[model samples]
Target: MRRAAASVTIVTILLLLTGCWDRLPLRDLQMIDVIGIDQDEKEQGVTVDLIVTSLKGAGKGQGEPIAERTTLKGPSVIEAVGKTEYMDQGPFLAVNTRAFLMSESFASDKPVEEFKFLLHAPYTSINTPVIVYAGKMVELVNNKSSNRQAPIEKLHNFIKSLNSNGVINNISMHEFISSADEPLEDYPLPVVRYHESKFQIEGAMLFHSGRYAGKQITNEQLRMLMFMLGVDQGRQRITGSVSDSKSGLQDITYGFSVKNVRRSVHTQKGTDRLPMVTIRVRLNINVFDIGDNIDTLKPNYAVVMEKLLGKQFEQEAAGMIRTAQQANCDVLGIGKHIKAFHPKLWKSLDWRKDYPNITIAPKFDIQILNTDGFEQFQ
Candidate 1:
């Protein structure tokens, strides 16, 4: 009797259950693969470009392509999205969207804080990779690859490569928010440019206090910066001459690749007068090429590599400090260091006011772990 009563109750609950209230059928919806945001030259407002992908059935004798695209634009992102509603299709869904490309002009003029509202919207995904382009968004979305993968997938894979290789700082929505909120930290966004047949990562956009600070760093300098911050993953080729132990007058040329980098930051308290900041870096390397053989190279290789690396590291550190000082931007988290070590002093002095004058000391130690082919020469 109890089982019969429970079955009746379960059937009643099942009868009340229905499909999602806001769900739209896939067949009746226009699927958007890419969204572009830029400044509208004619309207003095933002322009939203939607790239819609549709599929048509193949005829009996023909094999049709799987996807087709159509574009729609409007003064606002939402309006541009709504323009597709009049189509025979029921609605447009961007939840499956893979990429969002913003023009440099739009990103510079519109602070990211203004766009945070979109995070609350139902369709946008937080993990959707965002790319800032110096050129038009249309050009980016229309890019075709010789490879068979969809354009969106190709672009997403490229971004993943850049992040894993540490070529540029990967600035996501969460990181952007944290940097913007912190008083001491600044944000850097990867910059992209379209040149001829290919797209290239130009460098990074440096931001200070929620505004576009007028400072940009090149890819080479960015790599060096990442090395100092202990994020080095990309390949580096170094060429230099080292002195032979037996023959002081003879110089041997050598080249190597950096396999890994580890770094840490230290701060010395400021008495009522001065404060000091020190950065220490350790590098692991592999020798790939040698121009000449030095029998004594094995023992002295560490010393020579350390000196060369120390000089290179110092140059990069000084350049970063100068770049931020000139723009009055603090992207390195120097303020956080001060706050962590000397809270009382950090509270008394404003970092922004004193950052331009602060002194920095950088030290580096390079270790050669394995020589890929130097064993033959030895």
Candidate 2:
């Protein structure tokens, strides 16, 4: 009797100790890798596209499943997501989402309103990058990778590269929400497009008062913008033509890597109603390429190149500031600076009305450390 009772107790304990009793089987879970949000054409509903990978059972000899897209529509985000259950695949899980792609129209419609659902959704990853796509959400999510890598993986890696190069901010959903919550602050999101059979982060979407300003920053303007913000990642390369004093030599095109950057912003009471703001940036660079060598060993070579590069950036800064003012975007956070140091001035004026009228001066200082890479020998 005693042996039988001990055996029964052991059996009961073993049964209770078994793990994963409530866990969903892997084969039944459809993991979402990317979410694309877009507005319906009728303007009364939302469209949610889930790029997912479904798992298969053992011994099926099934290779890795290709990512498939499921489009669902409803009046709101929650309802749209809920509709995923009626599909043949298992329930949708968002914890594995790698990125969120928002259509230009959807992002322009009202960024905060459309993003609120993702902010509050349970089990969703908030740190995933939020990108603004130029084309249709369905086509972009379904597009195949050019190099045979997974489309979503390729995009994620590309974004990482751009972020490291200081080309884009790579803003996340959480960061966007935080910036939107703050006063006199705005955010820029990296913009991607399908070009030449591949996805590229070609520009950025600027926001003002939590709405798209209908402006995009690209190429040199984008680089200058990042430089002014003091966010240059030190790996950015710049190329421009500099006047060559050598006789009969055309202007030399030069390329250099940004080795270091020092930036400062100053705002003080001015003779006018709005405060005067000055943005100063100093760039330390290493010259790696010169279209034609004209005695780089000469003592004046570095000095002349530095002055020319400085002038070149000064002009670019003016254009960057113009674009920001036209969009009324305070990318530099000058208003935040005033609010922090000069509370009285910040409280007395409507920043939105005064921002466009204020004068912002950007000054650049360039230092060329070397020219050995392109040095000419007799």
Q: How do the residues 182-281 of candidate 1 rate in per-residue lDDT, one tens digit apiece?
A: 6666756778776775567987777775567888877655666777678876655556665545435245566777777888888775554457778787
TM-score per candidate, chains pooled: 0.78, 0.83
* lDDT of candidate 2 over 46-88, digit per residue (tens): 8988777665453466545556777889887667777756776
Q: Give the runs in model 1 whose Cα sits over 4 Å from its true position.
A: 8-21, 24-31, 53-92, 145-151, 174-180, 232-255, 270-274, 290-297, 371-378
Give the C-alpha lDDT of model 1. 0.65
Counting clashing residue pairs in each candidate, in order, gives 0, 0
Best by lDDT: 2
Sequence-dependent TM-score of model 1: 0.78
For each candidate in turn, give its C-alpha RMSD to the true structure in angstroms: 5.2, 5.3
lDDT of 2: 0.75
